[model samples]
Target: MPFENEFASYEPLRRILDNEKVQQLQDRLKVRAIEHDDETISEEITEKSQVEPSEYQPDMVLAIDGSYQAVKVENGFPGAEIGYVTVASVLILLEKIRELEREEFIDPKQFRETEKAATIDAVFPGCNVIVDDEDSAKSSMRRILFDELKNHIVFSEGETLLDTYEALLKIKLEQKSTPSRCPHDNCDAEFTYDYGEYQCPACGGKLYSSDAMRLHELMNPVGSNGEMYGQIMQTLEKLWLIHILRAFEKKGWLMTLRRVAFMMDGPLAVFSTSSWLTKAIIIELHRLNELAKKFTKQDLILLGIEKTGTFVNHFEDLDTTKEGVADKFPKQAALLLHDEYIKKNIIFSESLKPYGKDTYFGRKFFYKTSLGYKIVPSVAFFNEYQQNLTTARPNQFTRLADVMSLLDQVVSSRYKNAVTPLVSAHAEASIPLNLGRRIFEDIAREIREQS
Candidate 1:
C-alpha cells in the first residue's frame, strides 16, 4: 500500500482498538485517582515535629551517580557490541558551600572535579572472539566485573573497591561459600566454593567473587547488554558509598562518618538482576551506623534522594488541591510509605509480597522539604527488615529532620527538582551521546581495520 493510503485507512488498527476485549484490558490497566484527604491515609504523612535543626547535622556531603551507554561495533553475522559505564562521586564540603554563601569567588567546577570517577569497558563474546563456547559472554563479563571491582581506585591508594565489596560480602551475607552453575554451554553442573577465585570442576570454567551479584544471568552470546550494564552502574554507585565509608572506618574516622551525609542519586534499593545484593547492603549499612553511634555518640547519615519516579509523581499529586480542599501532604512533613498506601495509590494493585520486600534495602518516604522541594528519599534502619510497616512511623527515621535540613542547602536551580551535588555528579559522569558514539565508532573502526 502507498504511504498515504495506509495513513488514511486505519481499518486494521481500528478493529483492534474497538475490540471489547481490548477495552476490558484497558480498564484493568487504568490508573486510579489519588485520594486528596482521608483520615486513614493522613496517618502516613507526619508533620515535622522538630522546629529546630537537629544537633547532629552533617558538615560534608558525598553524592554518587552513574551513567552508561552501549553501541554496536559490527552489524553483519557474528556482530559485536561494547558498553561504557562511568560512575562519579562528588564531594561537597559545607564549608565550601558556606564560602559560596559568603560570596567568595570559587570555581564551581572544583566541586565536581574530584578524584572519584571511574569508567569501565564491557566487552561481549562477539566483540572479543576469545570464547570457546556460548557461555563466553557470561565468563568475560564476570571477569571484567571482578577485575574492575578488585582494582578500581576510588578514595585513595590505601584500599581498593574490592576491599569494601569483600568486607560487606563477609559481614552481611556471611557466605561460607559462593556458588554458581557452570557457565559453560551444555554443562549445567552446580558448584560451591569458598570466597575468592575458583573454577567449575565439571567444565573448568572460571568464577569470580563478583558472581554474588548474579549479573551473569542477564548475559547472552550476542545481543543488547544494556540492562546488564545498567545494573553494573547501579551496583558501582552503591559500592562507592560503602567503599568510602569503610575507608573512614578503617582509619578511625568515626567522627567524619557521623558528620558526613552520604547521598546517592537514586533509591537505596537494588532491583532486578541484582536484587539479592540489597539485603546484604542493608545489613552492612545498619551495622556501620550502629558502630558509628557506639563510638561517636551519633548515627552516620546516609540516604538516597530520587530526582523523579512514581513516588515523586504521587507526592506531586498529593500536594495539589482537590475539590477546594487543602494540600494532602503539608510542607515540612515526611510521609513514610507503607505497603497498603503504596499498593492502593501508586502501583494500583495488590500483591502477596509487601512493597519492596524482596528488592528494597530501605524504607522510601515522600518529603516536602521545609524549603519546599518535593523529594523522595529512602532511609535504611537496623530494624527495617524486622519491623512491621503498619507500626513504623516517620519518627523512626532518626535522620529525617537532619536530612531535610541538609537538603535545603543543596537544592539546585540548574536542574528541576534536584540537589546540587547529585546534579554535579551526574554532569561529571554523563557521556554525550553524539560525542561518545562517534568516539566508540572510531575505536570500533580502528579495531576492524587492525583485524
Candidate 2:
C-alpha cells in the first residue's frame, strides 16, 4: 500500500489506549498532594497584617520586562533562522498609580502626558545565515553582540552599556577569573578572563563583555539559535536593571534610588549558561543597597515578581481550600520557603544540591496581598543558600514590608495575580508572536531570493 493509503493501518492505537499497564504506571508516579490546614504549613505562612510596616512608600516604580522571538525560513536553500529581542523599562510615578487605584474607573485624559523610558532591541543571526561559510554565522553573531553591547548610549555623559557590564564584573568577579572556551569550530581551547575583554590566544578571535554570558555556546551553524535569543533577552534585562541604577547613583540621585521600587518581570535568577552572572548580580545588588543605606538610611526597593513557574503553582495550591476546610494559606500573608520545604514539597528532590544555589541571586517568597493577590517576589540576599534558614528566619525578609506596601497600591485584575507596573512593562516589551514570526520569515525569504 502507498503511504497516502496507510492512515488506518495502526490497530495498536486502540490497544495502547485500553492498556491497564499504562494506568498502573501513572498510579506509581510520585506526586505530592497539596496540603490544607497542616501544622508545618501554618508555621511558614506569616500574614502581612502581622508583620511590622516600613512606613516607606515609594515615589516611583520602574518595571523592566523583555520578549524574544525566532523565525525560521523554509524557503532558503539550507534554511535559516532570525531572532529578535526587545527589552523595555517603564517608569511610572507612585502618585499616579495611587490615583488610579483610588478611582475605580480609569480616565483617558489622565494619560495625555506621555513619559519616556529606556528601550533596547536587537536582531541576531541564527542557523544558516551564511550558506557557504559555516563560521560566518558564529563570527557575525559575536560581532553583532559586541557592537550592540558597546554602541548603546546608556548615559547622557557618554557611558555605554558595555562599560556598565565591565564595571559590574570587575566589582564582583574580577578577583576570580571566569573560564570559557573558544567558539571557533574544532578549537575548544580554554581561556580565563580577569575582566570582560579578552582575546582568544588560540584562534585570535576577539571577545567582548557580552562574551562572558557564554551565549555563544548555544549558537551553531545548523541548529536553531532560539535558546540563545531567550538567554540574550534575559541578560539584557538584567543589564538594563543595573544600568539604570548605576545611572541614578552616578548623577548623585540617591533620593531617587531610595524612593523608587524597581520591579523585574521574572525571578531574580540567571539560569543555564548565564547562571554564573548570578553571583555578580547578587554582589552588585548588595553594593547598591549598602550605598543607599549609607546615604538615605534605607535599602533600594528592587524586586523580581514572577507570574508563572513551579513556585507560582505551589503558591496557588497553598492559597486554595476545600469547600468546608479553612484557608490553607491565609490572605495578607507571606510564606518564605526554606530549603527543606522546597525540596520536600515543590522540587520533589531530596538531593544534597541546594535549590537555586548556582542560578538564583535572590530568595523567593510567596506573598498574598491585602487585596488577595498571590505574588512570588524574589529579593536579592547576601547569601540565599545559608544553612538552617527557615520561614521564621529574621533579617531574611529585607524590605519585604515595603514590598507588601507597594503591592497593596498596584493590584491588577487584568490577569490572575497580576500587578500594574508589570502589566505596563509587558505591554511595552511584548512583540506580536505569530505576526512577527511570519513577517521575519517573509523578509528572510526575500533576502535569500535576492542574494
Candidate that would win on TM-score: 2
The per-prediction tally of clashing pairs is 0, 1
- lDDT, residue 372, candidate 1: 71
- Look at candidate 1 and tell me the lDDT of residue 126: 26
Off by over 4 Å in 2: 1-24, 33-36, 72-77, 100-106, 112-116, 130-134, 171-173, 194-198, 323-328, 382-394, 431-451
Candidate 1 per-residue lDDT over residues 155-246, each given as its tens digit? 34457787778776675456445556765677999876335788778877677767777777876555677787788888888887777666
Q: For model 2, how does the per-residue alpha-carbon lDDT over 59-141 read when each residue is reduced to its tens digit? A: 66778889888877774547588788888766666665456657878776775222234466778888766533335777667
In model 1, what are the clashing residue pairs, if there are any? none
Model 1, total clashes = 0
Global Cα lDDT for candidate 1: 0.67
